[model samples]
Target: MKLMKDEIETRRTFAIISHPDAGKTTLTEKLLLFGGAIREAGTVKGRKNSKHAMSDWMEIEKQRGISVTSSVLEFQYDGYHVNILDTPGHEDFSEDTYRTLTAADSATMLIDAAKGVEAQTKKLFKVCKMRGIPIFTFMNKLDRQGRDPFELMEELENLLGIRSYPVGWPIGMGQSFKAVYDRHHKKLELYNPDNPKDIDIISLSGPDDPKLDEVINDEGLVAQFREELELLDVAGDDFDVDLIARGELTPIFFGSAISSFGVQTFLQHFLSLSPAPTVRESTIGPIDPKTREAFSGFIFKVQANMNAKHRDRVAFLRITSGRFKRGMSVKHVRTNKPLKLSQPTQFLAQNRSIVEEACAGDIIGLFDPGTFRIGDTLVEGEAFEFDEMPHFSPEHFAAITVKEALKHKSYEKGLQQLTEEGAIQLFRTYNKYVEQQIVGVVGVLQFEVLEHRLKGEYNVDIQLERQPFSFARWIDGPSKALATLKEKQRNLVTDREGRLVALFENEFQMRTAQDKYPELTFYENSFYKKSII
Candidate 1:
């Protein structure tokens, strides 16, 4: 048990989130570089370039140079077992990002220095706050001319409603960019653009060291930098570790992820400050990692057909409590049955190796034989589910048809499997006399992915025509009210589970129905409340 506790404490699981093109994948590769997970950091320059990001393993992602799904990688750094959840940064994949956050104990919110708080970043930031996950900000893209660090800090507080404390401050901007002042150690790490290969550490007598003046080579810039430091010292928020753990404050680090500057410093500081796997909430109660004896975990994500030859699926489970050994039998809490725990694997993106044992905070991949859903639970002892996993309402809708009559079976099978992975939502509706298959996604790019996967994975082609409906709301009300709603609007459809949904062309259409049928209740998401997401 002591050994198990040690294993849990040594693990640090976190997700990196940002808007698209904020250098998120770049930062993940650099962190992997520090972990020795890869010999060289793979560049995400497009498929034709023959080098793709290590975190993005999907072929579609390789071609598009954008991540549409989350990737998990586990490695060891400085005696700490690190599990990095590399999430999709695009706004289209925000739902995927939200799902990935549940398995993570904390998150590193990457921000583009030029564009401080972006739309997607703000959206994901709220989700992080919903779960109360501690956020550490990395103001990226310092290699180019960018925003004022002080303004960026203020934006975090004003726009995102979180205060930030800089662990290190940049010395200059743009071509004159020189070093980062490590406030804690009172040292300067110089940056040389000509030789941007390694970090140069220089001992400074103080912030006003003449050695720093020699490095900057500009007297006016030195005076301005010193004044900014004095102002920050006088007026900035005090470093409160407790507030940081509570997600109330963020420790900000400024660097360019593309150039790999200040990344090592960020990694070293992040490992020391980040929390280990903490207590996880379940239906029964709070499950404490320090005391629990039985192995338990929940499935946060499910990926299907990762390997073309194997045509297999993986259920990514984050162990909540206790220890798991190979070939152990655990109870499937959702189905109330015993499930054999065999063939557990750990990942470095798509590359994986079978792990003999894993403890709390470790995410392990179990070979899924089309059984696990997004929120299913597996436990060795008490049976309780972690119920916070949410079902988001899809905004974009389309009607899909099999391109060939003979390929109906293939289309159905492919659609079922893809929907099961939670890449898109499946629905059924009627057009005149025939039932039509409808697919919905939060973003339209998923439609392309759906088409691509159907053709590639299952060898079926689909004709996906866009629908006018912009919103879907699950209905809960008296049978008479629902019947009336369907009769009047003819906008009613059912989700995969046969839950009745009203597809509205616009909000006005929804409002007209609501005013007419007062007995009916509309819900944005299927089961969870608004705050839970």
Candidate 2:
């Protein structure tokens, strides 16, 4: 089975990751603008006369001006199909971002020119590195005063252990900011802050082009930029296209996303350098994106209630190979059952519409009515499964009880839906059938989101009581050992799926269990050899 070159080469799927307030959302809007996805770019913090960012559609997000979940946006630009995964920069939602990264073939790491690499950026970078995905660096907010370019490069190398190659260089810092020298094309892109959509492009014969001084306007700045360019060319490591594809080296671009300076230049260069949809690993073998085989994809995310008018749950599937068409019958690998995908849709964040057709590297949303789970694989006829999606261990625990006993049904349904979405983990005590249930989450902020959604979506108000347990481990052993552990441990509980687990008061208690019950195996996080559920 073979696909047309145009079909294969025109698709580009990537993710954007950064620390909070690094202008990541702004950069996404500007890219969409270049792609003609939107008529006018919307600011994240909507002004009195401006619209809110399209990607941040949730009501809470619009008010808070932060992305809490990952968004998938598809648009066409210059004869290519671009799929951008705009991920949350907030550290509390890092788990969601981690799952989203698994679906991307490449990543754009945004760094605040003034703050450099921060904690969340490092964590997200590690996930990208683990997948060996190519990363392109964008030093954002160059319009503001920031650290020297030389210092920023050094920090990237030392902190990430990856070599940096500057593709473009900024002329000046802060108010003096003017333009960027495009090293790849030997061109100058002059910035026009007032009319960012219109840029002045000047071609240079070489670094010594005499017209450079005239274009630069400032004679002193021209000489300084020329000297730095000369030094960088002579001393910097040679650009290796292969290394950049292997995630060993990052091509850096300087830009101001808010003002849209240098964004188009970065987008053009990024598409040229980034790899297209590649092969994915499966139980059978590597599935080539160009193979004209049957359609196959896996669920990376399950979002509930994208539309308030209807109680809908959407399962986001990243097509790994072949083509997808509406009303096609495919096998649900996990359940070993065939399902007719009647309503496949494409996303513009929360807003979506039915799509007639899609192909590999495209992210499609399927209408799920309590059937789909994260990491479920779908195929036309193949009987193989992809690698399991990883789940992070939760550090915080709490017991939740509905304030109004009459709303218990709604509370239960909401909890089940949210837990299935991986918003939080649900657990019940084995000692007694209590009305209150325990929940675990990677970060404490998740509790707030859980409460907010329960009240707003389910119309059920709940009270959350913080728990002291710091560690949870899934326990497995013979019936004798299980019974003995359950009798001795007051903190024993079962998850939503009825998996046996033991909660420890502290690290000391966990160690004591390990020492006492040598026959039982304790797992820090639940993982499947084949299916995620």
Candidate 3:
């Protein structure tokens, strides 16, 4: 077996983002297929019950055709190691997407060619911008009926605030879509199932080429195309045509992913153009929970494995910097918990390989930290602790009550376990009666998963109640009496200009310690202020 490099390594990691069903998972599967990870491609809708798609892990995801939790997959192409973070596209899982993005250097923003840029796509792109991550846009579903690619390009620029040049151009649209003209190669590559081993790139100005004839269909487009060709002819310039191809114009690729058409070309494009880990900038910090100067890595994901007889936990890690080795003790940032590293494993889907140590900027796995919690940073000493990635509080919340009266007591334990694994957040309301609420971004789809997992994994059945409007305000005084009286009482509210004026609640608030009174908290309360997330 060939050993990896001794001088650490070079790699490229990217989180794939898209609105739901824009084909992010399918695109990921195609990339993996081309990289020789799987023997065959699995469809989102399966023919047989036995064949499971690699990207969809949870039973709920498989049944619903959506991604809930993010999954990591690795493949080597052209001597470059690529780590792919496949994330959920639904708005409910947006926080998960953002947290996962922190571990990546760049992102591939996928949009449906038919629908153009959707709401979630724009939101995720802004997040990438905020994190200073470069983005590569993939206009997918070209085979579906849609507007012109040019219009889509305009939308991308206008909405996402990014300059997108096509890397490939589609030969046709809808059912007629057959080939992708490579802008870089200056040739049209036709997809051939029988010739999967070698893809043939054909020249454009050749004899009676059937592919070229098939591509130049629309009369208006044909006229413009010939005009461009003639302009190049008059310039006394030997137009390589490839130069036009090399520029950042969108390279449209055609073919159906279901048929495995043009999939190989996409893989070729990724291996050729996608930036690897070595090229990306690295951020280093400490592992200690008490301080920020030490080295600590954050575990962004944890999966509970209670499949049949196997009971184990899979921990996903993004090492900010420094080094972590097996048997070394590290502090868990969230709860000030200390953990002894057992074995560090490099995970690829379900398969894992043991590694002696993981260094800065590396995304790897840890073998069962028994009591692992998501968002906990593993640091060497007290000084290396850093804030967890900023996860948006769940927008839509629901009150879940036990369906079976007898199971109500056990539900909290099971639900708590789920939340501890970072599946969701459980909030205990300080009302007269204890009301445990599951707060999270609610995509209609993930709620299904939440209910399904509750039943399947925990064997608990619960009812859900969609919540109503709620907001938090910083008060000048502290008292249940003050909190109660602040009704219709616009006392004082602060604005962006730092001017405090009348802010009203349902009533006026009372003062506990009039001296220390209302300090006022904004969107950030205790946690964000403490961790600086």
List runs of model 1 lying over 4 Å from the truth. 430-433, 486-489, 528-533
| Local distance difference test, each candidate | 0.88, 0.88, 0.60
- For all predictions, the C-alpha RMSD in Å is 2.4, 1.8, 7.4
Residues 267-376, candidate 3: write the lDDT tens digits: 66654554433222223432321222234677777776533245456778886555667788878755676778786777566666777865555677776535666666
Q: Which candidate, 1 or 3, would have the higher lDDT against the true structure? A: 1
Q: What TM-score does prediction 1 earn?
A: 0.96
Query: Would you estimate the TM-scores of all the predictions?
Result: 0.96, 0.97, 0.76
Candidate 2 residue lDDT tens string, 142-233: 88999999999999899998889999999998888888999989999887766865789899997689988887789888889989999899
What TM-score, to 2 decimals, does candidate 3 have?
Answer: 0.76
